[model samples]
Target: MTRMPRRSVALAAAVAVLATACSAGGGAPKPKQIATGYTATPQQTGAPKDGGTITVALTPGLSPNYIYPYPPAAANGTVIGRGQMWRSLYRPSGEGDQVADAELSLAEPPAFSPDRKTVTIKMKDYKWSTGTPVTADDVVFSLALLKAALKESPANWSFYTPGQFPDGVSAEATAPDTLTLKLETAYNPSYLLSMLTLLYVMPSAEWNIAETGGEHLDFKDPKNAKAIYNYLTEQSAEQSTFATNPLWQVVNGPYKLKSFDPTTGSFSLVPNENYSGPGDSRLDQVDFKAFTSAAAVLNQFKAGTLTVGTLDSSYVTQIDELKAKGYSVYGAPAPARFDALTINFANTVDNFDKVIAQPYVRQALQRLIDQNGYIASRGIYNGAGSPNYSTAGSGSPYPPAFGDTPPYPYDPAAAEKLLTGNGWKVVPNGVTTCENPGTGAGQCGAGIEKGQKISFTLASANTPAYVGARDVAFSSAAKKLGIEVKIVTKALNYMYANYGNTFAPATKNEWAMQDFGPLYLAAGYPSSNTVFNADGSFNLGSYRNAEVDKLINESTFGADEKTLSAEVTRLAEDLPVLFFPTPHTLVVVKDTLSGPQSSFNALLSYLYSPEQWYFHS
Candidate 1:
């Protein structure tokens, strides 16, 4: 995965002992601490052995809703689960978080035609568990299905425009094993390949439904499109009994679903004996269990019941105790996401627009945030977190590197100076009122009225301990700077529903700023088209910069690393969001199990090389 400079480590062995002492009434003895850095090399027992069952943990309450993996609402768990049964044309290379490299799975490296407007893919010698040979016709059919589904559910596919095929892209099966894609416009090979990675090849025989009157339905027909899309979508949602679902039984990956419980969001998988992949599944079965909170997950770890799980930064101090119990902790800088404070440019609450409209104010706010302190308090893996300076996170390959110096350092004095210089009167823990309110010199930019106070509510998800704490810390800091910040906590779903992209000025859910997330997985890529562009769907803040939009468009089609880096550098210089420290993903696995633990991509499901995972017996 992408590597960042390590932060200075502080030993907190005493804290671990104290925590254990406070909970000594437990039946099991307190776990002992072991001396080590953030990551310890997983212990190897011998040759890999099969037949043992491994239980994995999932995020609480989040279930796999759409088992047939097309995106608008395919939960992370669904990606991980469906991956076992569905195979894509090309699987992302598991080397790290980079999406540039791809491993040929269902199809070999595509042969591109001159001018790069056309490519041909040849099928690999793979077969479905149902004894049917995987063919190119299946690929063409899947692409058609995706195009049709985009009509009814546009958000399902973000990379392409809805209701229309991708610019100049058309697919057809030339032979049983050969499929060709012709593009009208020239596109970068890497970008095109990345696009292909998103399209999962489905079994056409099972998914393509016949319309009423025994006629084959044309998905492109406006009359038949919605019905066809709904039929396929509804079939995938029937997950009350996974084992009994015939649609799920066919497999191309290493595992197949054995059973699933809709209530607890728990499921089990067994090896796909007919899987034709690089390696075979070593474990006989794998189980996934969901928990509501980190504390609950920790309890499972303490009982030595979890085969594989994650530990957040709050649990970093408890690593030694976990190590003493024969668990191996592996830490990797989070490859695909970054935590950030998003300010809504379109915020309509209490004249919030009047104050935050000024770029100087946004820059000032960024400078006032104690990013490093926040990371130190919330991070679990020592030396793993780094300040994210731009939407293109620190881990991204593209960058005008921000280096060690932040554009806006955490200096409250400097922040106060900027605000006061821009015609705002500093009241110190009181409301900051604008004295001048025009675009002229010494004024608070445009749209500000005299005496307009800098006061707004910051919203965030209430769970995950860190989310609430981060917001509180930010709110407290702002308060000291003569800004009134009302902290409102809400469930994640409610927050997203009201504050997400669907947010509008007239809605009851008006938020001045939102403190949620590492940005979505797609934003992790070097391009800013999806997050920073003027019309970006995920631009929840509605921030629009003509220059940034131009740069994003250029990067989207293709750009050299130098050009891409310059664009990112300028973005950091322009404070679009209050970039926080990038969080590290800590993977804790039983000493007896081993496989690839580092994930450089957005989907955690892609992190596991199931064929290679095995019990070290």
Candidate 2:
């Protein structure tokens, strides 16, 4: 008998910070402000009742791509929609705690080999909607197909490196219900299990058409790999009509797509009677409707048309009005996400590389940022936010002891002193110019030429009314320290494209800093390896530090929390990215709905436990 590892049980704390509440009129009283690190519990107004339709409002639009959970480009709606049909090996127990416990969904908790190189997973006795039994072979086939698709989309398989599949790691069916995975590398058992949370099982019989002529098609073969990937991706994309698609009709989860309208971004889901999951869905029907703006969603909530909706910081002031209208509001700080001002270290224009590279300069900038003031200005509900000093952000799975303490207080005088002492002439509320250029004390740092001015362009997404206010505050604060900050607002897509692109010598420097969040996803295990590593794929700022790189790499495979905490502490001190207030996720639900639990997986919304939700009548 294989003993369950302690690390595996500790995985229960994997739920990251991510939540909602309402008030009556009288100019809508100030929304209750909650501090950071608070975990939201599901709203309990009444006992669960069966057979009711809950209409959920989503902003922007539903995903155009078919609801394929594995693809990196999968939309938020697609992920939620896929969750309704496809079942993962483990599911978050909807208990409304800060740390969520992983319960068996389709398979039992995996048993590990003594050497920790192998994981044995046993499939639960479950059947798909098509009356097909979910077996170990299905798990093997799903892993094989994902391994093949990795070449086509590296982001989809971010946990592993190129050519690591089938060689560094391999999976096989040892028994009809038992699947075993062997890894060439000895990784942290906890980290490995966290990564498996992302692995969603697909039907082998439905998706295995790529294998032709009875010959094993090696995904390593470029031509064959491309063909197979295209075939799978296209099938997922073409699933426009949910009811007509034979492939989508067969699901293992509690709900199935009853109707989908791609144009309006509206869809309806009905309970899957054949689902073999832990609990039965109480709702008879679920509808997802798209809204163009946050105000629209709020209006729908006030009208009692939407059972659930999200409120941005702009709407925080309206908490009373929502409550007056009879909506329950809930709020909590996001766990994996935080907004920050990211400086481009690779930017060579205007001596940006020289100025931003200095620790003193970055520290001075940190001192100028009033995170608490920014939160107040936004009327951020429920004290729902807090200053994020490290890349790990608030609500991380790691211990608080590992997080960094704020080194710089909000003091413009101190900021000016730091700059002036460094041989930069102080010009309060204006651009400061370098007076001395040398490595010696009281001289501008190396590579910074005399007369170089402290100035840079900052870009941010146009939406969210608070971003503009935050930009203004940042600019005003920098001005007091003689820094010239030009704020530019652009479409979120344009901002993301420019901000996220890797630095190139031939490319023109677009913006020096970007304001966005919560930057990293908790699914990656709160490790700095993927976001802060010198060679990280998502290291948009091109910030590189040898010490940081080493710590992050070690933390990726380090089993102990001590190792991980050390890395977080180091990053907090280094200030690779300027910290900002973590935005709180506020969700509004109708009094009629019950069992609306939060999950680290869906940080921005309350769609984690739709199956458990029901209308109280």
Candidate 3:
């Protein structure tokens, strides 16, 4: 499909976040206070009974828009359907490990050749709704389309690095059920497997045509592949036809697109009777109801109209009220995810690019985030957030020392000093202005002129509630350092679609900072290829550092497996984006509904397993 810089990221999980943190001070490290109140997989009660529709509440403003696997924006930018209508070749792990789920995966674990230059994948015993075996041909067709889309634009897939992946590799269905890729260079098993997780196998027999109702052609031909990519993308764009299109009905996943509301982006899914995977379709259908506002979702929960959904941290205090309504409230920091205020270095508004380009300035801005305070503040995370310092949030096997100990912990006094040291005249209650113009140790960085103000808008998502609450908290903290931090609230979808500087250059100056929630890397291997590489498609802020790039390369290519953690540690200290506490997403699911606990794990991206769920007594 489309791509991530070197890794794949879905532009979602704006699900409420929480984290763990150590104090900023030099003394004995403050006890690591990551709240443990919320569990990812709470024990389900009751015996299963078959066939009931589960009306799930889609995150407000974060409904399905693009139906194609290759998302065009932030979240490599947003994948439509996987684990539902279509299944990825390798399923991301729900347990937050750096591996695929064997039971749900469409293929066996990849077997790498001795030199690690080749990968062989065997298809599982699965078939499409049309009774055709899910084979290597489908995988080949999918990758061909992915390559064709990437040729059109890297925006089609955020995880792609220009010379990596489908670029030099040759893929084919060696056997009817076996797919092999002969890579020009060796790659880490984890990294390669993670990439495969985004490769959603489509019904090749039905979708291989270049035109509507056209004859199927050999997709192996580059021209035919390109035409097929164009045709599928064109169909995906017509959201109204998502359910009715005959081409969309030949599914292999547990659920199939039943109906779609072009308006509100809500849709219905029915059981795919021919889904050849673990678990039965105990639920009759699933209605994903979308909302214009988070408040509307909250109202739905209050009215008991929402059977399963996530509640923002701002509404966690209403747990008892929700409990009275038979909903189980559980929350946790999503695995392989980190929440942060993505600093847009391209936004030249108020000389923000020049000002923020300085290492000291970014450090100062990061120092203003009161992670513990946010957890302690009822207005924000309300004890639900755990401070996270690295891109590989909590529970990741490889978080640098800085992961637990923030390099720039909350300190308003330290922030002011950093500005003053950088030749800025600090005003406690007024706007701070640059007093030095040179690119020296005692002067503001290069291109920054005297009297320049450190001011930029922090575009925050209005849904998750904590996104706004925390951004406001940061804005207020910046005021103390003479930095003008303006908080502008926007919908998650608008920010996810329009806030990226790399994709939407026209709106480059619209926002200097955006907290559209966390960016999830490939399961198990959280590489920062596209997200941090200078030439990365998902490097929205245009963060560039030669050393950082080297580290990412070494991890992704070099034999030193430990290099990945080193890369993360370096990013933590470097401050590519201002780090925030990872808050626990408070899920409110009616206790009467039960399923595999792994299905609700937030770290697994937008994947959900409703097929395993059913209303029980």
Which candidate's lDDT is highest?
3
List CA RMSD, all candidates: 5.9, 7.7, 5.6
Poorest lDDT segment (10 consecutive residues) of candidate 3: 1-10
Q: What's the lDDT of the predicted structure labeled candidate 1?
A: 0.65
TM-score of each: 0.87, 0.85, 0.91
Residue-level lDDT tens digits of model 3 in 224-343: 999988888778777788888888888889888888887777888888888879888898889988776667878899998888887766666567678788777777776777888888
- Each model's lDDT comes to 0.65, 0.64, 0.77
TM-score of candidate 3 versus the correct structure, residues matched by position: 0.91
Among the numbered candidates, top TM-score falls to 3
Per-residue lDDT, model 3, residue 184, is: 94
Tens digit per residue, CA lDDT, model 1, 172-200: 88999999998776655655666676678
Better of 1 and 2 by lDDT: 1
lDDT of 2: 0.64
